[model samples]
Target: MSLRSTMHIPAVPAFLDSVRLRDIQLPLPAAPDPWHRLGKPQPCTASLKLSYSSAIAAAEKDDVSLSIDYGKLFRRLETDVREMAQHTSSPEHPHHRMVSVEGTRREEMKASAVGQDPRVTAGIVANCGLSLLDETAAGVRRMSHLRQSPRNSFSGSQAPPAPQPADAGPAPITAEYGRCEVWLQLPKALLRAEEGLKYRSVTVWGYNDEAGADALESESRSPVVLEEEFRIEGIRCYCILGVNSHERVEKQAVIISLGFEGPGQLAWGSTVVDTYVALTRAVAEKVDETTFQTVEALATFVARIVTVDFGNERVTVRVEKPSALPFVQRSGVEVTRTQAFFQSHEVAHSTLATRGEARSIEVLVGPASSLTLFRCPKQAALYPLEEPFIVQR
Candidate 1:
């Protein structure tokens, strides 16, 4: 039937509508008793009463218009119910389609999502490890500022300071000097030699001064005045001789002195002597003119000695063979002297007379005539003068 016609059909209850009746007749059963099954047994009333209520109700209420309207409403309701079920169950409905589209779009969005770039974060971590920043947040801010700032602004400032020079001033002085007093013990064999044959005992009195003159000269805007003194005491040997006698021997005694010279030119009071008699002999041989020449030569020699280290200085030397007549059992002599700007502590035979022997010799060096002495014949006579110095052991 057409949908419109189905909607217009007369109403029928669902129970009654589902029931069906056969169109054909059935044969009757043979009677069992003669009393005859009177007329056909009353229709099965019990079945009719239990299962045919809708049909009975329909038969009792016969309003054609109302039935027709009810049938139309029921047909419409059924049609509406069927359509609702179809819509709820179908996979292609608008709601289901919309959900599928949404799910697919969500998956696509996830697949297209961009991963984070780690270059900037990695740079920040490295910078922090190097102590360039306290944390990642601060590092990021700093980088941002740096990117935005002008590059040339930081490059225009002044350069760092330079280091100072080393040789900018005069150096400090360290040289030193002094004088000394010494005693010497001698051997008799050494005293018997020509140079030693004049003394029985010997004494040494000397001074030393080292001014570090080089340093003073370098730093001083003006000239420097330097003075020094020394006192030294040590055991040594000497040869002694009588004032007039030629015989000599060795004796031990304390020697003392007031003036001493460095290895520089000999001063006016430094010398080596053994006897007054020998001193007299040496003096007697000198005429006034010869003595003058000798003195001048001696001065020149001293100057030569002193100037060996410093050219701008003068020195004086003296040799005195003091008489030993009263102090010793025999007669003898002692010698002493000084020098200025001396350069050495050693005494050489060549430093004294070229014809006499020296039992002991001392030298002073520097501005402070520091005194140094030698008692060994080989060392004291290093210059090998014709006269040898008597050095006992």
Candidate 2:
């Protein structure tokens, strides 16, 4: 039976015709811990869906052009994800090299302005689990998983059912932020795999091939969401924040929890562009430099800093003041913002997008690392340094 003869089925939406790379499991970098031991490669799974309008016509003619070659796509995705997890994003303030325990301990003590500070010690200990990726055998297993699917490609399935033009509407280019457990439906299309193209097996959501149709049917029944979570916890800092004048006289303890929501290549062992440490330090420095009358204002400011500094799709900032009230257990504020929030606020726009030149002292660390010292936006005369800072746990 030819694919052209399979036209008894109803016309599907253009968005429904796409090449999907799902259930991709790869090894991640180990957590940032000097004391951490390198173990077996730990694999984490991620999914991707893509579409090209010209694929339908190309499949009909058995032409390679315009159709997505999923075998090639998957290979590229694996390499890109691995590279993304390996490199440190910041030019200065590279992460401490994972080496001897004694060297790590020495560095830890040196990092704290006051030798053996309890808070600093706690911060360093907490950062042990921060890496998102770990080197693992999961890559080998993933390759096998990709190959397990039967080779039911769109090439030469005896011609596609007539010719169907893509919809004139704008392409489905969207990025939504939410906590949902479901997979996005990739567009269904016929692709002409290159001759001798190894790993041609693709697990399509809906297709009746020698591959398990029952399993595919089960998957087609429930779609998946395209999003992941990035978290930073136990971020403790001292800031001049309080409602009362007495409280404003001295610095109080504040713990921050940051939850980043977005769609991107996130590995368990890779630093999300050193965001966890960078943003946490930025929040502390921002809070320390300025006095806040309310927790709401502090939370809002931190949220804005996170959105701008990291270029995250969405952020949720929770500022906890454990010793705010004598009798109360804790008092704090939680604020959430999307990219749209910064776009809407004029102050946020300037804070994130605007970078001005001002006189300040620059400090060189080691042979390569250097700090770009500058004045805070609100306090031009203060000369508060925003150097790359790290805190692991």
Candidate 3:
């Protein structure tokens, strides 16, 4: 698909169509206290795409049985993921809480202490004071500072990392807020010098079981599987975002995460710095202006802002409400949408009514400044975007 939304002629045949379901929410069990120790539990957003030419046969013959039924697949996944999330995130699920001082070491110490004379033991105990690290509360709040680098993020070491575990404290150690899984696949032929060729016949798509797994593990494709991605996290904003009576009147704090995929490169004439400034401002503006009844609604709305207004092929949005559940760190939903998605659906939003007469923000035609978004210095240049965005005061 084209990276930017424009009227275009598709070069590929119709039989090569793929069915994709993106950004399916799977709530995870709460993370461990000192949440990164054994495993971190956090809500996860996932995507799945199945590319096969069998769909063409079904379409050509109008036979429903020959092709995939996306609805059935979605419902099954939803049920399974929801059950897993509920089981894992439940407070009473079988999880070892903080280990108290009664392990084998304590038992050994007791045995050794039994043989010692009371006077000598008392004297030794008195001489050396027993300083307890256990008495101090766990600094759960400080975990926010631990994941400053991308390596610490839980989502991907290859693609852009997702948000790590964070909590304000007194919240269970199991609170996991942000993680994303995007398992995407394109043809292996994309790496060749002369690109944009379709080699596969629209009539077939599968392989022998062993050969298929082996082909996936090939050296050239193994590492590069992480798709070209652009992501921004921790966009803190306030809006009405729940079904509760009080939630309807009061604006609550929400952290939104936004990201999109490009076809290896960016749109023509676009720069990473300019895209970031423009998208960040646009997301903030849209988020602040729209009031959503649910986190999922908020996620979808933000996704439309990127895929429609911003003209990106695929975009994902995760919206978290910090105050929703006191026991969990943050609860939210994530969604991924494309330009084609908006084309097929009618999005009726009461929150996005037109404001007063609009005026266009002019592009910078003169000397650039430190705050300029028109161009980035040579060192930071990456990706292409359509037009220049004006970053005002």
Candidate 4:
């Protein structure tokens, strides 16, 4: 995709506070290490600063339910980190004493160490943090720091050396211990308000209560989106996509762009290129079967196909109608959809019917400044009552 043609939004605001965990232990993989044959997990220290937010009311009331659960997050991180250590080998590990090896032995050693790769452990942070963010009371937060201990070599004849920084000058090949450190700062906006609210009756440790509605509004007005993206660009199609009389009678030339983000790797033996081809075909087929009065509808249709038919975790679809106006080169509409969006949409529609409340419900997506109403069917299966009445996408 051409960089010039893509849309860019600079700096998505992240409203949050931070929790710090220093010097926690990590485990090693269970497999016998080619280097550390001792087969026992080593203990290491880890420092992490987790950025999160609690409701202004909850923070004031000292409600743990509305706050991030430090104990739970710690246990999860501990298990993941230790498993990575156990299955992997390091030059400093007890088993990896020799400096040189050749042929099958070298290959076997590398293969055995695959799970121990730094990237593997890094993924623990990337995959785990989002859900915690969702659980936070204010709903917009981030993880600012992630670090793991270093690996140092040790000699059998000497006492294990003291733990050293990963960036510290090279250590002895047989050194035993290393240290991990991570630091992240919460967004200043949240901190500023937190500092203002102090009450003699209650001690609010991590957040403030003084700003009141303004603070809550500011926090709710800006949300942080952590997205991984894939794009399909410059696909040309013909559609009846406009409100004008001339546009309805004739098919107009349009350009389409799509981007997707999702968790989980592709199924084994499948490639991204393969997925793109299939997605393109599905989009083309949908366009052929439908007629739209506006670019927004066309874009929404494409987004639905990617999310529903293709099972994309999330998608952004843009449809550009060129020559709609003589003076203008082109104009388009863009729409974003996600799995959570569909689920919430279904719930909202279902809630309206069963609760016998309002005749219809309009879902507002994102922050207050830019909101889109998600359209849903009037009739559907029973929705779980446990679903929140207000669904935020």
TM-score of each: 0.16, 0.37, 0.33, 0.32
Best of the candidates, TM-score: 2
Q: Model 4, 308-340: lDDT tens per residue?
A: 666666677888878787878878888887757
Per-residue CA lDDT of model 2 for 161-269, tens digit only, reads: 4433566323321111001121211111001111100111111112222334344322112111123345565466776666553453356788777765543222211
Q: Can you write out model 3's per-residue Cα lDDT over 207-320, one digit (the tens) per residue? A: 222333444222211101112344566677776566654464456888887665543222311232124446656777667655555677677777777767776667678888
**lDDT (CA) for every model shown?**
0.23, 0.39, 0.39, 0.41
lDDT for model 4 comes to: 0.41
Backbone N/Cα/C clashes per model:
56, 32, 5, 19
Single out the weakest 10-residue window by summed lDDT for candidate 3: 128-137
Please, what are the lDDT tens digits per residue for candidate 1 over residues 1-393? Answer: 001110111122234321221111211111011122322211110000011112232244452311112233233333422343343345343212111101211112112111111111111111112111112224334644554455634554544333335553221111111111111111111211122111111111111113233432221111010111111111122223222212122222212111233321112111221121232233222211111112333333333333332232333333222334456543222233223424453343244444233343443211223423433222323333222333222
Clashing pairs in 3: 30-174, 31-174, 42-176, 270-384, 270-385
Whole-model alpha-carbon lDDT for candidate 1: 0.23
Model 4: number of clashes?
Answer: 19
Report residue 53 deviation for candidate 1 (angstroms).
Answer: 99
User: Residue 27 of candidate 3: its Cα lDDT?
Assistant: 43
- Candidate 3 segments exceeding 4 Å error: 1-226, 266-274, 349-393
RMSD of each: 64.2, 22.2, 29.2, 24.8
Which residue segments of model 2 deviate by more than 4 Å?
A: 1-29, 34-227, 262-274, 347-393
- Looking at model 3, residue 54 earns an lDDT score of 29
Q: How far off is residue 42 in model 3, in Å?
A: 29
Q: Against the true structure, candidate 2 has what lDDT?
A: 0.39
Candidate 1 residues lying further than 4 Å off, grouped into runs, are 1-226, 231-236, 241-243, 246-323, 327-393
- Candidate 3, residue 303: the lDDT equals 74
Q: Is candidate 1 or candidate 3 better by TM-score?
A: 3
